[model samples]
Target chain A: MDEVRNVIELKDVTKDYGDFKLDRVSFAVPEGTVCGFIGQNGAGKPTTINLILDVISRDAGEITLFGQSVDRNSAALREDVGVVFDEMGFHEFMTGRDINIMMKNIYRNWDEAAFFENLRTFSLPSKKKCGAFSRGMRMKLQIAVALSHHAKLLIMDEPTSGLDPIVRNEMIGIFREFVMEEDHTILLSSHITGDLERIADEVVFINGGRIVLTGNKDEILEKHGILKCKKEDLPGISESLIVSSEVSSFGAQALINDRASAEKLYPGAVIEQAALEEIMIGYVNGKR
Target chain B: MKGLILKDLMCLKKQLTTFVYVMAGTVVISILYVLSTRYGNLARVGEQLLDQNNGMSRVDVKNLGSEAMVLFMFLPIVCVGDLMNVFVADGKAGFYKVSSSLPVPLYKRVLARFLTIYTLFGLGVLVDALLAVLLCSMTDIMSLGQFLGVIFSGASILSIYSALMILYCVLLGYGREQYAQVLALLTMAAAFVIIKFDSVRFFVVHVLGDGVGFDSSVFWKPLDFIREKGYVLLGIAALVSVCSYLLSVRIAERKRGVI
Candidate 1:
């Protein structure tokens, strides 16, 4: 069997801004997997993204893209990396044609035909100024630009945040199409866990500038369980297995780290598998 | 880098359109001014002034038309070349966030902005030079060499201002291009005062403080300086641009800064 390659990797990355810091962040995104970077607002998500893109300098630690250290002024590495932000960064007055003209000169492998074809497929008018575009249209335009240059890695920050469900589904379909190519990978950062649960092969959870949990999506969801019991029986559950517990008038509900162990140990208690959102909440609540 | 330059040019679209209209207006007015010097209202004004003998000469009358032509020449340059607008537009649109992610390196990004300013300045100079040729053909007040000198001087001066503004834009960061413009002007003024302290002191102490005789040649001094000393200004502009580029590259590399 061939060893899997990490398309993007950060080893103990750190960026300090006095009020907040990305404290020793480490994660490796394997090639061809969609790694959902789930974090709440002000959880250092954007800052980490900025550091990975080299839009801002990191205080310490190593960031490697495509196996090369990023600190070596590795802008050349971005030729194969595509990025999409929450906002449309293109000038309001710029048309699709204007963007094509500008980008064709920037990227060495920029394909004019594919770019316009993306515009046509996305239903974005080539001659119309992008300022007239709706929020969904703006996001689509950004996606079109990201896809046009044949990038291998797509790093999108909240690409589906504000869009209607239909548009979000459409974007998901586009992302699915992108990842269908065996070598293509995506690192999507968003607080929306539903989107991640639908598509992510791997999940990296971050909170308060720290890596909360990271692993294969299925394993994380499978290992975690919501075990509910009466208040009197709560202490009987092993201390190590309970991630966090909540008490109500009727019973006690605990999020267990090891679902199989909890089920084997307490066969009478109602134990159900956890969703990604529940797992994320359990970890966050456990931290708090 | 060429792509970034094209983006900046896109930012200047409205200004360039305004420049076209201004250029057209200047051309029509300048041609009329040229014709008026020989056979129109300006000729009558010159005759009337000569008859009155209010101590102004035919040469001074001709200099009036030259001064008017000079104003026309500077207007187009002003319309087309303002490095601040590009920064302002970038700040407004948050383009640096996208540009910073592009494969182009930081130093190249800085250079592209500097190149955009010069591209506009070059366009302004070329158009002005062509206009100069036409005006020189129709008038005897100023030679083609003199007009070209002033054009070069004006471009070089704007280049210095522009170079300083780009440095300030990088130094100050985004959403502060207005401050960059003011700071650039203030810096230029401070530098001028520092370099010409003796001349400034002489003018203040002798011309204003002591109420020394007012010389009529003071009116012609600016035109003479711009026409005769353009190459020196060009040299200074080049030096400032190189210094600004180096400094901007340093700041950008250190801060991962505004482009």
Candidate 2:
């Protein structure tokens, strides 16, 4: 495998907020790859993003973006980075045209033509206030702004959480288009595993502020498997291979961390490839 | 920096009507002060004398001075109000957090806000001085020298007050909103207490109460001190404004949240 360059790197990042602590989390997003940041509510997704953006200071750690320290490059290097929060982060009173004008002044490389083109393509009126926009429309507007700035890295948090299926698909398609340039990267944080499954090249799962899994999507899927066997046989299976399991009167379905070992050990049972959602659920359930 | 300032200006564009209303209110209040002082008939003095048991209808010059004080008093309020409008609008709409994600430096963001508030405050002071000069002349309430003194002294005091108000708004912008309110009340209390002191009250009355024909013997010493050192006071106000701005920028840079 060719060594890929990382565009976003978090090394031993830690943040303490009295009630919760993000304990020494570390991950890297390679260039041109869609890195899905998977976590449940209160799992420190926003906190990490905030630290990267310097919206809040980090307690301890080093974050580098675009080959520069985030602390030192906050102003200069941010020109090549785009960010979209779960909320639109725009004044509801502003129209799309207003935002375009504002962005033109804000980003030196802001492509006015591209922004307008996006508005037209999205069927969003340039003069209409964003307060009147539908949830999908708001998400589209943010995506448009993120793309128009000539950003090398796009960081988005929950960009598709509330969107309808069609809109989410459209957003995914847009992400695919963005990554086609071979230099563009995306750090997309979403709870919707299906969207990540469709588009993400790499996945990083975070639970309780700690990274549980980080690797290529295909490898993770291949390494973990679901083994179905009689309920009585679950206790007899090797505990090391079992991530988590569900036992019922009819049978037992267990998620195995190592598929080859599980297949070798349970010769009579059926083993199926685990989806990303199941893998995440298995880890989460295992913690309990 | 220009972009950040432009964003604030764009946000303030919606407040044009409010600006007009505030100016109109200032004019009405100025006119009332002029009428109450120059045209006491408007206060219904003759009717008050006829209705009351006492036949004497003395014009309450102190009351008129208080009313005139309110006209200048409104300066700080308008200054504070305009600054609040820009910050509150950005905050309530979540654009402040959005700005943190942009390429603009945090210092520039803080500087933009300081510039916006002080720029508007400076403009307000100019308009206010002009209004005072015109109304005082039209009513023949005070001599030209006294009006000049009024302009110099009033502008200096109001500038300091406006700077303090900006500091309060900066606190609010940095999300110490509860502290902002406390600071505002405390500042107001301190201002009133300071004003009640003989020296400060004498200076205030010498400038603002010139039209009321105040007997200067009681405050002659402080009044003379202010006249000689008036320019120094202006310098002090300028110094305070600059220091407050620097402090605000420092606080804003270290702020942890958007609001």
Candidate 3:
């Protein structure tokens, strides 16, 4: 494999909010890779995004994007980056045309033709008020704006959260297309593990503002498994082999970190490949 | 900066449109009122001069001159109101959070806001001056000097008002609606209390109260004070305005994290 350049790198980034702290969190997103930033509600995904955008100040640590410090490069680099929040960040009265005009003034690289093309492709009316847009349409509009500026990176927070599966699949397809250039990247924060499972090249799981897992998606999936065994065998299974387990009246099912090792230790147990959702759940449950 | 101002203008489009129509209507009404009543006032003045023995030489035309001064005072208020509305609109749309991700610098954003308010206020002053001239010409109540003095005094006071309002908004931080409301109430109460002070009373009365409009004896005092200390006062106002702007930018920079 060719050595990949990191588009985003955070080393010991910390932000203290008195009540909640992003405790020395660290991760990196390589160029051209779709990094899935997985976290539960209030788990600091938004905080991390905000910090990267220089919207919020961090207490300690370094965050470099596009090979430069955010503090110095935020303004210049923003021309090449696109951001979409969970909520549409435009005023209610503005139309798609109004946004285009405003963005034309804001971004030097803004492409009016691309924006209009996106509007046509997304079936959005240019004259209608965005306040009246459906959730799916709003997300599409944000995507259009994000893509129109010739952005090298797309930082999306819950971009597919409330969309229907059809819309989500379409959005995912669009993202796949965006990354085909091999220089474009995306840092998508979402709760939908299934979406990440399909599109993510790298997965970074954050729980309580701490990174629990960060690795290539396939390898992370390959290393974890769910072991089903009789209740009597649960006590015999070593604690080191079990990540987390659920015990029921009939039997026990435990998530194991190393499938081969678990298989060697529990010969009678049945082991199954763990999905992203199962792995996340196992890690979260085990952490608690 | 231009983009930020454009966004602010778009946010204020409805309010600004209504204001334009209202000002246009006011201009039409003033023209009609001046045309209709000027001849009547002239006839009354003619009769007064003819019956000069009665010792009532001139009836106070009391025309729209005072009303024009009132309008000048209201201009700064409108500017302040519009400025606040822009903040509120931005808050509602979460524009600050969104803007941070944009390529514009923080100071540029703040400068854009200040420039918008100042531009509107400048336009307001010009319109008020034109209206004052028209009203004075039709009524012959106030001399040109007196009209200019009233407008100048009103603008001076209102400039200070606007600067303080901007400072309040900046220091209070963005989207703090409840705190802003409380501060407004406190400011109103403070205004009422401060008026009791001798210096403040002199200043307020000269600029806004009966001293300028109704009391002829103290009428020229404001004009005289302005003539003697006009440059100094304007200098002070400019200095304060600059300080207020710089402080506002600093506050905005510090609070951007919270926003």
Ranking under TM-score, best-scoring first?
1, 3, 2
Candidate 3 lDDT, B86-135, residue by residue in tens:
77887788777678888888777777777776666676667667776777
Best by DockQ: 1
CAPRI rating of model 3:
medium
Candidate 3 Cα outliers beyond 4 Å, as residue runs: B41-81, B129-159, B173-197, B200-215, B223-237, B257-259
lDDT of 1 by residue, B1-259 (tens): 9999999999999899999999999999889988987899888988898899788888777777778877878888888888777888898888988898899989899999999999999999999999999999988978999888888888988999999999988999988888989998999999989998987787778777876845546567777778678898999999999999999999988878477
Q: Candidate 3: which pairs clash? A: none
Q: Give all candidates' CA lDDT scores.
A: 0.90, 0.77, 0.79
Q: Indicate the residue-level lDDT of B184 in model 1.
A: 89
Q: Please tell me how candidate 2 rates in CAPRI terms.
A: medium
Quote the positional error of residue B20 for candidate 3 in Å: 1.8
lDDT of 1 by residue, A1-288 (tens): 989999899999999999998999999999999999998889989998888888899989999998888775567988898899999999999999999999999998898999999999999999999999999999999989999999999999999999999999999999999999999999999999999999999999999999989999999999999999999999999999988899999999999999988889999999998988888888888889
Ranking by lDDT: 1, 3, 2
When summed lDDT is taken over every stretch of 10 residues in candidate 2 chain B, the lowest stretch is: B55-64
TM-score of 1: 0.97
- DockQ score of candidate 2? 0.60
What is the fraction of true interface contacts found in candidate 3? 0.72
Highest TM-score, which number? Answer: 1
Per-prediction TM-score to the true structure, in the order listed = 0.97, 0.83, 0.87
Q: Cα deviation in Å at residue B194, candidate 3? A: 7.2
Off by over 4 Å in 1: B47-62, B208-210
Model 3 chain B worst lDDT run, 10 consecutive residues:
B55-64
